[model samples]
Target: MRIVIFSDIHGNAVALEAVLAHIRHETAPDLIIVAGDLVADGPRPAESLAILRALPNTRFVIGNTDYDVVHERDIEYDFTRAQLSAEDLQWLDDLPFAQTVAAAPGRELLVVHANPCDLRAAIKPDHSPAIIRPLLDGVSQEIVAFGHYHVPFVRTVDRYTLVDVASVGFPRDGLLRAVYVTLTFDGANWQIAHHRIAFDAEAVARDYAAVGYPNAERKARKLLEARYRHP
Candidate 1:
């Protein structure tokens, strides 16, 4: 079985399109998981949601930003809400926090926006085993996949193989490319592959300006630099 997972698509349809195209051209995945943070930042929130919803064999888990958008808690929630329809907001509200699926006959895979404990809680790549283990208290799955920090990484903590699929829109790892993860399970074990695809950062910048996106300057700078910047 093969699975592709991506997250942190905080709008930016251009980046999402590039990542989706890469997934289509490169692999025939049995399942596709959109881990969360669908649309809360950047531009084209509705378009980004539509693209993911139209894909086949896809599962969704709500991210912290998704939750914030639904609850009107995000700083830019009003801007994002203005771009989406009532139905779109409802769809975001209905997304589950986590998904556990059978990767193979006897193997299970856990997918979440962040850690299983909380959508806002992050499990960073630099964290040690002791720091990571407690965050996964009740998780029994062999593989735990998530994306929240916008930084991609794969780490093993105790019995769990933790995979951060990374960000498609707002990547903060200093790599100016859309990122996603592919998992291939051969009954016995799961092999992980990370794919980064280049996209037009200038187009994204134009999108923010074109749409009058909130904090357009900061967002464009972050996207171009591929790292977080203070406003």
Candidate 2:
């Protein structure tokens, strides 16, 4: 089975489009998993959600930003909610925290926005096993995949192979390219591949001003820099 998973598309439809194009050109997987944060920080919130909704055979897991938008918990929530309709919000709210897929008869793959314990808890690449083990407390899957940190990484901890599929939009890994992961499972083992697609960073950055997105300057600057910045 071949599966593609991507997350942290913080409202940049342009970047998502580029990633989707890459997914179609290469790694035509059997299933696509959208590990969340669909919209809430950049421009084109509604459009981003619509694009992902149109995908076939895809599973979704809600992320911290999605949770905030649904519950109206953060400053960005109001702005994101203003751009979305009732149905869009309902779809975000209805997303599960985690999804499990059967890779083989006894092998399984787990997908989540972040760690299983908390959507806000990021599983960074540098974290030790002790820091990651508790996050996988009740997880029984041999392979676990997630996205939240926006940095791609694959780590093995005790019995679990943790895969951070990275961000499709708003990547903070010192690169402007949109990234995701593809998993190919043979009868017994899983092979992982990370794909990074270059999109028009300038166009996406300019979209903030074009759409009059809130905190446009800071967000645009962050996108160009490909790193997080304090607002």
Best by TM-score: 2
Mind giving the per-residue lDDT tens digits that candidate 1 earns over 136-199?
9988788999998888899888888999999999888888889999999887878999999898
Question: Once model 2 is optimally superposed onto the true structure by TM-score, how far is the C-alpha of residue 176 displaced, in angstroms?
Answer: 0.8
What's every prediction's RMSD, in angstroms? 1.7, 1.5
Candidate 1, which ten residues in sequence have the lowest lDDT sum? Answer: 222-231
**Model 2: lDDT to the true structure:** 0.89
**What lDDT tens digits, residue by residue, belong to model 2 across residues 150-185?**
889998999899999988898888988899899999
lDDT of each: 0.88, 0.89
Question: In candidate 2, which residue pairs get closer than 3 Å at backbone N, Cα or C atoms, i.e. clash?
Answer: none
**How many Å off is the CA of 4 in candidate 2?**
0.6
Q: What is the lDDT of residue 206 in candidate 1?
A: 76
Candidate 2 residues lying further than 4 Å off, grouped into runs, are: 73-75, 229-231
